[model samples]
Target chain A: MRPRLFTPGPTQIPERVRVAMSNPMMHHRGSEFKEILAGVIDDLHYFFQTEGDVFVLTSSGTGAMEACVVNLLSRDEKVLTVSGGKFGERWGELCVAYGANTHIHNVPWGDAVNPDDIKKFLRENSDTRAVFITHSETSTGVASDVETIAGIVHNNSDALLVVDSITSAGVLPFKMDEWGIDVAVTGSQKGLMAPPGLSVVAMSQRAWERVGSSNMPKFYFDFKKEKVALAKTATAWTPGITLLMGLRESLSMIRAEGLENMWANYARLAHATRQGALALGLELFAHSPSDSLTAIKVPESIDGIKFVNRMREKYGITVAGGQAQLKGRIFRIAHMGYYDALDMVAMASAVELTLRDFNWNFEPGAGVRAVQRIFMEDE
Target chain B: MRPRLFTPGPTQIPERVRVAMSNPMMHHRGSEFKEILAGVIDDLHYFFQTEGDVFVLTSSGTGAMEACVVNLLSRDEKVLTVSGGKFGERWGELCVAYGANTHIHNVPWGDAVNPDDIKKFLRENSDTRAVFITHSETSTGVASDVETIAGIVHNNSDALLVVDSITSAGVLPFKMDEWGIDVAVTGSQKGLMAPPGLSVVAMSQRAWERVGSSNMPKFYFDFKKEKVALAKTATAWTPGITLLMGLRESLSMIRAEGLENMWANYARLAHATRQGALALGLELFAHSPSDSLTAIKVPESIDGIKFVNRMREKYGITVAGGQAQLKGRIFRIAHMGYYDALDMVAMASAVELTLRDFNWNFEPGAGVRAVQRIFMEDE
Candidate 1:
């Protein structure tokens, strides 16, 4: 049997989506493809809850983040970056790479940034061009309160509120237009339930205004160029046709479920998974956890590496371990896209068996029972 | 029935490769993924026929072309760009975007650059950092003499011979090591017989030497960072997992056929296709033609768009019309990767029927019979 994926991003793709990828590729410039483009674009805007223009890129999510920097900010431009975890830190790294004088607000890992810190920074730096925030910090399973932060930025100054919603766009409740976010970036592989390849970015009229004044060297990821092509239901370069076809199918699945119900389901899965882990005497890592995934602190006596390996090799279930500083201390089990209560229970059961085999201080079926009870009560 | 693609890229993905894409995506950092990455990288080296490192990028071929520019050249560095087609022109655009002072040598739209002109240009520009060339210009169906050009550039100056072999790598005879090319860039959808998503680039030691000194501003496409990750059998960012699995299957098919036999097969098919088109009183557009695909001048009486549309709508075969300035003047039919003699004959028959249906000048079955005769002669 194939191992099930429980990583934060690159989660398990639904069979329907994978089957859509099997459709034979066609010319990107053909009318048939343009029709697909028009439908997919409309569906993306509906999913993003934004009336603004969203552009598809043949790149990873980081490329979209880089596009946000190069297309909206100039050299030595002042931007405030919120770095709570790895994805958040990437915003700062890209800013530095582009020669932006960025002020990074460092929130400790495993914690969400307080909205007030952003307000205070905006007050001190009224000339900031943008406020870069990660909606979901996958490394720590913490989602920042982007709604409040967007409000704070828009109220304080003319700074654009740019959010990296790669892991949160479809899994969480994010309304770009209602929340007044100027730019929202994401990828196809995460909550969108498609294979990796295409990155998506939606920009408000306010952000487009900044693009006209911005002078950053870019060719492949020029947002203005992509926007022009999208206007004609075309792409500036060859589109990632196969991934886009899969995305249309995945978006159809998302729309059928309705975004609100999907978000609610993720919340239940996270709750059940966390409840199962806690029932086995494991501690939760994040104070303000995200529904996309749940992070748990490993018991001191158990090797986190060996524990994850056992879950994979012994039971054919894959979970992600903590990165960088928390490598040996925390492990993350995601129930993001294409996952349900039974998938969560299977992971929990594997965890229970692996920990029991290691002689950890836990009941053998404690986690599995907790997961099952949570699902039954929810039903 | 779905339309068959004969465009330069986003070509028809084979059934086995499509089946491979159906495998559930695994985590990028998992043990299973690392194993896959190691194997893919090894096979890519063999396919490229180079001892140097090849990096798997999750973007299109243009992204890999941009990587060669940003990673190997700093601001205001002198580089000679040979532009004949759209993809070839992209190298200059990227260099100019990155502040490189490029001297573009324009080869007329359908012809290849002469080796002597490059030799003379290198003599004039002794301080040139790189010589950008295209192995197969898909837009014009012109295959540049990259092997000869690489020799001229190496013998004259310290310039790195960068070749955009997007359509030629798998369809034609290309030896990265033997030809002394410094950088070779390609996409998966063309001759590799996989879906669009992953772009492959191999860099020689000579090009890596310049990377350390290059000061181009880049983050997502930093080649040095990708190399470090590849050393550990990993990627710097999340990879296109499903596409890579599909690529492994495609590469196995390519190797089983043997690169030399594959190249010969493409040559024969191209000859048959050109012979078929010529038999219909069609004029070949490119003087120096490519085996990957063929370009032919459209009849003055026929509408290029309608002609292509008729082939697709009536016969379920898709051919490409010209881009930019040549939109109504020419059409392209590809015989690259996974196409056999019968496939070529089917396309030729469609062209004959579509042209006849449009009441343009063509004899019935002349094109099909010519293609059959060529294939039989080869046998």
Candidate 2:
């Protein structure tokens, strides 16, 4: 059997998107590609829910994060970074790497960052140039309250509110213009329902002013050059043509489903998965779980590494093992993109089967029953 | 009819490679992907003809160029750049953007840079840190003698030899280790027979020593982090997973054809294309033409812009128009990846028909006859 993907970022691609990409290659500078790009740009405005500028870059999500840092602030500038998981810590690392004077607000793993702490950091360090936040930390399956943090930063300091919404943008209720976010970035994977190549970034008017004066030396990630090319319905460099073709279909799928309905579907899937895990007497790993994925703590009697390996080797289900400090302690089941309630039930059933082999105390059909109940009640 | 891609890049992807990418998505951290990455890394050494470190980065070829500059030299360091066309000019621009003390050696648009002039530049400025050269200037279809320049830099100064082999690596005879190149970079779209997302870089032992002490602040393009991850058959960041799958098949196709045969095929195609254009009494653009593409100067009586438009509208063909200074004066027909001699015949036939539409003095079938003769002779 073909292995199923239940990971957070590199989710399953829909059939139409795959077929669209499988068609013949087209030149980037051709009129056909320009029309496709213009349509993508229009669709991106709906994706980001912003009246500001939105750009597509041909890199992974981490490159988008670096573009945000290099474009918004100069060297030696003060910034506040919130760290609660692996992805959150990357913001601080990026700041340090680019010679920014970063003040990291550390939060406990499996817990979300507090908005009050961000306000306190801005108050203490009155000259912060930017504030970095991870809307959905994929490593811990925790979602921070970005809207509250954006409010706190906006009311307190002149710092630009930059967000890494790689796993949150299309899966959750994110309104870039409504939240007054300066910069928000996401990848083609995860909530975008495409493959992992292109990354999209939306900038507010406030962010564009800072980008013009930022002294960071950049070329590939230069926002101004990209903006100039975007005016002509082109990209600064030759983009990933096949991936963008896939994205055009994925974005169309999202639009047809309606962004609001897609977010609601993800919420339902997350709810069912969480209930199924709880029904098996498994403990959750995150204090505030993201709708994107759910992290479950491994039982003490079970070998976490072996449990994960068996899920892949025997069941042909590819779920994500915990990263960094939480390695072998937890496993994440994603409900992010191109997944539905039936998929959640299959995942819950796989967990039940895997647990029986580990000699864990769990009823055979209990987890799957709980997932079905959640969907049945909603219907 | 489906539109044929005769543009330099993004080139025509092989059907097998596209089928490979259309398979179901797999997790990047899974064992299956790790095996794929390991195989790709092994095959890349054969692709670049290097025993030194080879890395695949998820960005455009321009990003690979920027990676070489940022990882090898610090700010305010002296460097020499040779510019003969648009792609060549980019090397100098990258150096200046990163605050390097850049000295650009400008050659005429259609001519290759003189190797002796590079010797003079290094001798006059003995403190040069790196010498940058474009192996194939794509805009003008000019090919520089990289082997001769590599020797000049190695024998003359302590400068590192960095080459932008984006259009030349798999199409031409570029032996990274054999030529003593310090750094060489190429993109997937041209010679690799893959889509346009991933770029590969090969670095010598001498370049690694400089990378250790280079103080340019970088995160996404960090070669150290990539090198460490590569040792484990992984990437520092989440890569373009689908593109990498496509690359595996493309590299396999390259290996099956044998690298030497692929180079000879490109040379034959370039020769046939040049002879075909010359048979119609057309002038060639470059003094030293690259084997990857052929640029033909448009006759003054024909409207260049309309000639290009009619080639696309009347017939389903997409060839690249000249860029920058050569724009509207010349047109380029690429004989790069996934193209055979029949594709060359079709391209030449299209050019003949387009010229006839503009009432130019050219006999029908002369160009096609020359192309057919070349292929028949080879058989």
Candidate 3:
């Protein structure tokens, strides 16, 4: 049996999105392909709720994150980064690679960064050129308060507020304009409900000016060149046309469902998942959680890797193990993309079965029942 | 009617390959996905005819190109580049983007770079770290003499030889080991018969050593991180699982046909296309034309854009127009990926009809007869 994907990324792609990718290849530079691409950009802008310039790059979300750095900051420029999980540390590492002066506001592994800490750092370091943070830290399943942080950044200095929204853009509330997010990046595989390989980056006019003044060297991820080419409905190089086609289909689905409705659906699923985990006697890892996914702390007796493997081998269900330092301690259950109530219940049932196999004390059928109760209550 | 794609990149995808991508999404970090990824790497090694490390990146071929420069060269490192066409110039541009001191071995457009010039330059500048050239320059349809240049680079200095086989990998004769290519990059959409969004890069041990010492910044395209994760058939970031499924099918077709047979087929198609174009009184652009694509220079009386537009409007055929400065002067017809003798004849017939619409002096059945004669002779 084919495994159902409940991983944080490479999420469950709908049959329609998969079918859309099967369309015969088209010339990326041709007018027909451009028409499809322009449609995607328009839909993405609507989803992002920003009139700012949005561009799609043929890469994972990390590529777009790197673009945020290479385009907005020059060598030796000061950047303030918030480190709370695996993805949060990525900002500091990227800055180090680019020879930038990085100041990290680090938190515990499963905790979200406080906006007050960001304000303090900005006050202490007036030379900070940018503040990089993860809107939703997938590794910890925690969502940072981007709106509060963005407001603080604007009030303090002219530093651009950059957010990695890879796992949250579609599943949660991410209003680029309303949140005052200068630059936001996302990938196709997560909340966008498509496969990987395509990334979207939306930038405000203020962010565009910063990109122009930044002296960092880049070519493939050059936002300015990409923007100019995109204005003509083309790209500087051959794009991943098949992935773009998939993205167009996925975005159409998102628009049809309506962004607000989609976010609400995710929130409902996440609440059900949390309730189900509690019913199984498992604990949530995050103090503040994101609706996209949930990080569950494995019981002391239960091996996380073994549990993940058992789910895959026996039940043909695929979920994500804890990343980096959290390995074998926690596991993540994704509730984004093409996921629904049935998916949540199925995952909850699997967790219940796997916990019993591991000899962890959990009531049989309790988790699924709890999820059903939550769904009914919400209805 | 389904439109025929004859563009240089994003070439025609086979029905079987398209069907392969329709498989349901798989979790990238799962064992099942790893099995598929390992199979692709093994097949790629076989196709490349090298035991060197091969990496699959989720981007266009240009991203692989950037990976090559960023992973191999440090700031202010001197490199030699050959610019004969649009893609060749890309090497120089990327090198500049990475702050590499670049020396250009300039060749006029539509002509192959002279190996002797490269050898002389390397001898004069011993600090030149690498030599970059394109095996097949898609814009001009010129296939450079990489074998000779590789031999010259090895004989002259310790410089690495990097070749862009984006448009030539499967169709052209390229033995990475025998040809002394340290780094070679190709895309999936061309001769691989897969859709766009997947790029393959093969590296020698010497190149890997350079990557270790190079300090240029990278994350999503990080070769070292990818190499470690790919050992277990996983990517550092979310991969394009759907595209990988498509590539698996395409590779199966390649193996069944045999690489030698595939190369011979491309050569035959190239010969028939050139003969057909010549019969229609069209000039071939490249002095050393690639087997993958045939570039036909339009007559002064006929607008190349109009000729291309009419072919698409009338016959639903999409061809590639000239690049940058060469726009409206030439058009390219690709015979790569899922194309056969019948497809070639159809394209030739469409070109014949479109040219006739422009009042060109040509016999009614000239192009088709020439192509048929070539096929009959081959039989």
> Which model scores highest in lDDT?
2
Which pairs of residues clash in candidate 3, taking residues 3 or more apart in a chain or in different chains?
none
Predicted chain A of model 1: TM-score relative to the true chain A? 0.98
lDDT of 2 by residue, A26-55 (tens): 999888999889888899899889999999
Model 3 over residues B1-379: C-alpha lDDT tens digits?
5588888877888899899898888877666778889889989997887889999998889999999999998889999999998899999999988889988878999998888999889999999899999999999999988888999999999999999999989989989998889999999888888988889999999999999999887777889998997777777777778889999989988999999999999999999999999999889999999999999999999888988999998989999889888999999989888899989999999998898899999998899999989999987
Model 1: per-residue lDDT, tens digit, B55-79?
A: 9998889988988999999999999
Candidate 3 residue lDDT tens string, A1-379: 5578898887888899889888888888777788999999999899788999999998888888888899999989999999999899999998887878998889998888888998988998999999999989999999988888989999998789999999999988989999799999999899898888889999999999998888887888999899899889987778888888888898999999999999999999999999999998889999999999999998888778898899888888888899889998998999988989988999998888788888888779999999989889986
Better of 2 and 3 by lDDT: 2
Q: Tell me the deviation in Å of residue B378 in model 2.
A: 2.0
Q: What TM-score does candidate 1 reach? A: 0.98
Off by over 4 Å in 2: none
Model 1 sits at a Cα RMSD from the real structure of 1.3
Among these predicted structures, which one has the highest DockQ? 2
CAPRI-wise, candidate 2 is high
- Alpha-carbon TM-score of each model against the true structure: 0.98, 0.99, 0.98
